[model samples]
Target: MTAAITPTTREALARRIADLALAVPGRVRVAVDGPPPTAPVELAEAVAELLRAAGRPPLVADARDWLRPASVRLEYGRTDVDMFLDGWLDEGALRRELLGPAGADGSGRVLRRFHDAGRDRAFRDDYTTLAADAVVVLAGELLLGRGLPFDLRVHLRMSTAALGRRLPADLGWTLPAHERYETERSPGKEADLLVLSDHPERPAIRS
Candidate 1:
């Protein structure tokens, strides 16, 4: 079992992200990548809160919101591992609608959300301009190694056993895709920062 994370340690991680966000000259794009069970959403929220407290306007986005239509995602099958790894996310749309607008050289106008997974319909939201020093935090699985332009990339990693224990029985089929990600993408080594999240409550940074 992983050790419990102390309040101090959690605060430190938030501070580190805040510092990095502040260091960027203009708008910053940050990726909080991890498996679903690792609860990357929570981490992203925490980082956003810290950035906001530090006087930076922060926007949080979910990769799930950028998923392809169900028709496209289910082209192979509901449980197709390859599709889950590669086809589920609409990376092109994500780049065109959100990432590109939020990049350094691009305009800071961003769509807060798109593609509602539940209803499988497009989300029609107006674009909002971010402040010059604003920061965008996107949380999701398989975000790294996609050649996406993110100023800061933070990866949360879990052991195979831990992932297995945390994943629900229905999601068992996706295990192979995650294993492939580890072997092929090596996000833990490629990310700017790595957090060991075998136990959500007790996280450790890989130095």
Candidate 2:
């Protein structure tokens, strides 16, 4: 009998293995999708480590590296929730430089970082060639439902109260964007792996 697919179980795969390459062949582009307070970066690193242990190369990158210039990002206003949901990330550059190039037929040369949001300037980094079977782990907030091609989509879900409680007071304005994301994108349904991280001590995986 076939195993019922869930967040913790695939047909022939289990949550413990973490050999995600079996799920997606050749070069894989994985999106560690979550809001900022959910800390997608940490989960990304863990995924990379698992790949490394399994003798696969995993290149961890952040979407913040491809953020649009503050001028464009803040055109409507700094706290525009719509802009936060849609316009902040430079998806075109992200596709051109990193995710697109990591595809099966794409050139192995991948651009590591493109833009620096801190100084609001471009990064001075050379292109690095990714191994044929390497995994590109891109972590960031609001990554899903944008039509980006990712082999494995892992969404770190959190409750509204959890998000508000963990998020810093200054960044409270960004909550509406996440709310919009839930209503519009339906990440829980779209994600390949869904993890409920409301309680930091123990995250529940759907059975």
Give me the candidate number with maximum TM-score: 1
Q: Please report, as a residue range, the 10-residue window in candidate 2 with the lowest summed lDDT.
A: 8-17
- Residue 111, candidate 2: how far off, in angstroms? 1.4
What C-alpha lDDT do the candidate models reach, one value each?
A: 0.86, 0.80
Regions of candidate 1 where Cα sits further than 4 Å from its true position: 1-8
User: Candidate 1: which pairs clash?
Assistant: 5-202
Q: Write the residue-wise lDDT of candidate 1 on 70-148 in tens digits.
A: 9999998899999999899888987987888899888888887889989999998888998888899999999988888
Write down the TM-score of every candidate.
Answer: 0.93, 0.89
| Candidate 2 overall lDDT versus native | 0.80
